[model samples]
Target: MAISSYDISSANTELARRAGYVDAQWALPAINAVELRRLQRRSNLHATLSTSLWLGLTVIAGFAVVATAWSWWSIPSVAVYAALYGGASDSRWHEMGHGTAFRSRRANDVIYYLACFMLLRGPTIWRWSHYRHHTDTIIKGHDAEIAFQRPPSVARTLWRFTHLQGGSELLLRLVRHAGGRLDDEAKELVPAHERRRVVLESRIMIGVLLIAVIATVVLRSAIPVVLIGGSTFLGGWLVVFFGITQHAGLQENVFDHRLNTRTVMMNPVFRFLYLNMNFHVEHHMFPSVPYYSLPSLHGEISSQLAPALPSTWAAYRQIIGAFRRQQVDPNYEIPLELPKIEGDARPVEIGAESWMRGPSGEVIVGLETSFGLGELRKVDIGRHSVVVGRTESGSLFACEGWCTHAKVHLGEGAVIGEEIECPKHNARFDCRTGEATRKPAKDGLTTYPVTVSKGRVSVHLVGIDSVGS
Candidate 1:
């Protein structure tokens, strides 16, 4: 059936009401221009320094472990050191994976590859899957980051398997998934090129494993490998445990922003161990923000987000209780509906048209048919208030009708240099490149390309391919 415009509006309104929000207040926790710029600068500094410290500690710990390995008594001590090093290195690697640890893309790539090599994981595969997770968090059937679903009978069987081996079962699952023979349905989640790259990297990781095995044989001592390897295993498991605790039992509601994810405010120890991942909801809201800056970003807008989720400990307790009751009920489902916004008669542009504007007298840039929304099966067009402005150098930039990070419009944000700052969360995005310049936003703003011909400015309704392209 051909869908009518009225059906779209009615669906949107119903969705908004179910989400417990008013259309007028859809834009939230407004902030002024100056604060946004300040926050961006602070986030940049924190990300850089934190990443460096973690890397330096990892190197030092590795040397210490090797030096202590001379004595049999030091085997367990070396194990402890190896675990600490692995965990700490993984923290820095996580930041690099997000492209927030280093300003240079090449440097981030180097760190990411090295970290993945040590962890026996695939960097390209991790990036493809993680990027998708950020774009479609809590989106069931589409998001692969969520654990695989199982029927009640299968769940019971899996529980029995886990009970038999305890930690070994978890390790077996990782091996099976990373064995480079993913099923057709599982393969679709990753880009084809990335899947190939992952298979290649997995081969390289196998080489590393072989070298470790050879070393054990040469030394005529399986004890060192067992001790050191056990530590590495424990460290990797801790990282996985942190992820499980963060999202397990959280509602997977694609359209309902409030119930979709959990929020955690961590103590300093947990923050250090998990690398500030405790702020999962804030991270979800702003994926581009570096991990180091998440805690500060969360603090700035805590009041605005408090209504959606409870304290971190509350979430932890809830998950524990659920686990005890069912032993293996991984599905925490919630109904979702898109929110609504009430405003003046303003044209809203999507994807590329978002970047263009008409001549001085005409604010609208493109006709309705310009945007390629044929593939979007369900869409709603309402009065959207967008912040459109030109920089001092005459470059035009368009952001969300509201800041996805803090629900404030870009109109209230200030343009500094080449970036626009989000007042409420101190988030910032490069106007020229449309890349996020600060934490909390993993994905950038949907940017549109602008063009001018014979004094008439036109915004393209296509996606931006690059900064200038």
Candidate 2:
């Protein structure tokens, strides 16, 4: 396959997909059942408390800015308000968008939509864009979220601190989307079925900003604007500050996130504000795990990965040094000190027509003892791959072996309760009915009937139905 030239801007080129950049092969470190369960556990109380605290602080900061207007106190007050609005919202946007932060889907949607408006992004537009980002992280000509391209520009990097370029581009795109004019890049990312929804969301957000503008005009004060949208620009500096540490001077077009992504050890306060996103490499590798569990996940896999930066200052120094060297030699890349991963095992490949078929045409997977309770296994029957899972309660189910959304083998993914999560994009499906229960996976898997008779597990090839039918 011919690899495409690196271009950070265009998404419709189709070169990345043709060259096999999209959904390219990646390595997975071996993990045991206990650690996987702990990492995948989502606590409603923890999520609610964390979200409530952030919201309460934002409300207080907004009120402080209003009360301290036209005074020296306003300077710090505005800064706080902006950090809450722009900086903290970035993390909220990310966590909530993943739907892993909150156990309740409604809660995640509520915060996700709110953060979308606050960040001046179209909800549907950004959702799909983010999906692509995870599917092709740091893959040149495919990953839309690449922060810094090759041949880094010093002046542009400095200007990003103000977020003027990013903010202006966001606003311009918002206006165009609101007017029902989708750009080529956006058209490629956002599905046609979601275009109308994007336009509607953009219009609604624009209308809200207009209301803030009207209030500012009526009251002859910038308070309403500051409270509404101006804070994003003022507070957006911290977003850039922390975001640059992620992949600024790292290698691109690589399948491994350890080389393309960075994990920085941030202060407690910064961790709180960024919602543990400082463990970015772990988050990308195991996206099924929620933000609250990222630290544990990092600890579990950190030995096989590179050592995290000691501090934000240390990360900046490295990034700056790399940027300087890149100015002279565009090929310069920061060498990562990663430990060797040991005993790494790949997924088991099943051949077509490998399993035995009974007289009734039912595929005989194995003995009842083959499937452990709450374990997922892959089986092949006459060129078809099937996923057979047993719940802790001893219920057996069979379905399509691969994730409907990404075609990734579900056998390698984690099983929580009766749901199996896709390892590639974290999309989930209910094992019993093969129903898609998560985003980035709208289509459900095809379920097959499984029966255990005489201590043998048998799967019926007939009567396969897609999820929700």
Candidate 3:
């Protein structure tokens, strides 16, 4: 029998790459610059409050479990703690992992590691893995995060709810990666630069686990491990409960997120636990937008997306039906009657058509409105592919178009305060001076002088002799 297309090393992987599926540009609904920027703003205050609340609840629940120990009341108490620890941490880790939860890099990092450990996910390894998940989405053979593999297994899916098998696999992988061992698929998924960090982080997680195990042995009690490593298995059902609803039985290997993702209407509690991730389609489409602002973002581009499922209950029915049919046919897809998006447009300014010679030594980039606040344009001039952006504070700046760390277009990224964040890796660059403000972006960008006068925006060109694509 042929290898499954879902296998990373299968021939279908090469086929997808050759067919332009891997790292292919996904379609986005157009939204004006100003509104998008408002939605994209990250706030430390918001993230801090949410983090504090979740932590506070978890702490209270933990104490309750201790207070009621050896009594039947401890069961409910532990359940609450597990839901907060094992369940809610999944969403927390996801938002923090994207660096969208907080404006402070330190805060995001702190939460990301905490959430990852709670869920038994290796911090560094899963960070890179998520990058692939976003890059390829549900593209078989390339994307590592496909929740339900083709010819879906109902039993395995049901088993995930117990978290017994799922959590063990994660723990086992952490051990392997900590020992400096990576499978072929993991090696290919993770960049060489990130592998060492992966190993280091794995060791850290394993060390923590070892300490918990030793405590369990020394104390002659399961309490130590129960509070630590055991929390993952106990609380993982919540993770599976919320996670299974996203992208399950949806279309795969598609460039349009609207076609492959769902937006389900959930109650306030579910929204809180999932961190507003029920806007899965919007989250996937505009990843730079923070969790706090997802609701507004949905309002901005809701018309362009499929109607939100009436409820999570509705989505589950659809998913189950699709899964059942796919079990037999293996190639079935849930028919998503997507609204026709006229123009199928993206919010971008093409360089070739937008640039002209100004009266002075500068090139007329566009009007002030053309390069509005929080807008990045890829301007190709002579030998340069320049990224021109207006920061949220209404200041204009220009720099190299591609990320120095990775060859992704900076125009597709979001401008955060004074720094421009890479869409692919969340690497940050100083918009004013072109300095690499954050990693995965080590090399600074080459900046150019930008000027605005009488509502006209222009850029000073450097040694331009020819214009070619």
For each candidate in turn, the TM-score is 0.60, 0.90, 0.92
Per-residue lDDT of 250 in model 1: 48
1-469, model 1: which lDDT tens digit per residue? 2211212133433453355432223123322233333333324455556666666665565566566666784666565555555455566667677655454555766877776655545566556556546654544444546652221243543453232343353334335555767444336445564566656666666566566678789988654454333445545545544565556554643433344556666567667767787777666555445566676666765555544334556665765565544445444342323233223212112222343334442245443333221111011113444444455355665444456554555554545546665533445687766787754455677665655565544444453333231
Candidates' lDDT values, in order? 0.50, 0.81, 0.84
Where is model 3 poorest over a 10-residue stretch in terms of lDDT?
Answer: 345-354
lDDT of 3 by residue, 1-469 (tens): 3335677774667877887888787787877655776787899999999999999999998888778885999899888999999999999999999999999888999999999999999887687778888888998887878877778899988888899999999999998988999867678767787788888888999999999999989988776787788889999999888887888888887898888888999999999999999999999987888999999999988998889998999999989999999999988988777776667646432333357776766777778787666777777776678888888788899887888976678877888888899866688999988999875677898888887889887877665555542
lDDT of 1 at 372: 21
Q: Give the TM-score comparing model 1 with the true structure, all chains together.
A: 0.60
RMSD for each model, in Å, please?
10.8, 3.9, 2.7
By TM-score: ranked, best first: 3, 2, 1
- Global CA lDDT computed for model 2: 0.81
Model 3 alpha-carbon drift over 4 Å, by segment:
1-3, 10-12, 345-353, 366-385, 392-395, 404-408, 439-443, 451-457
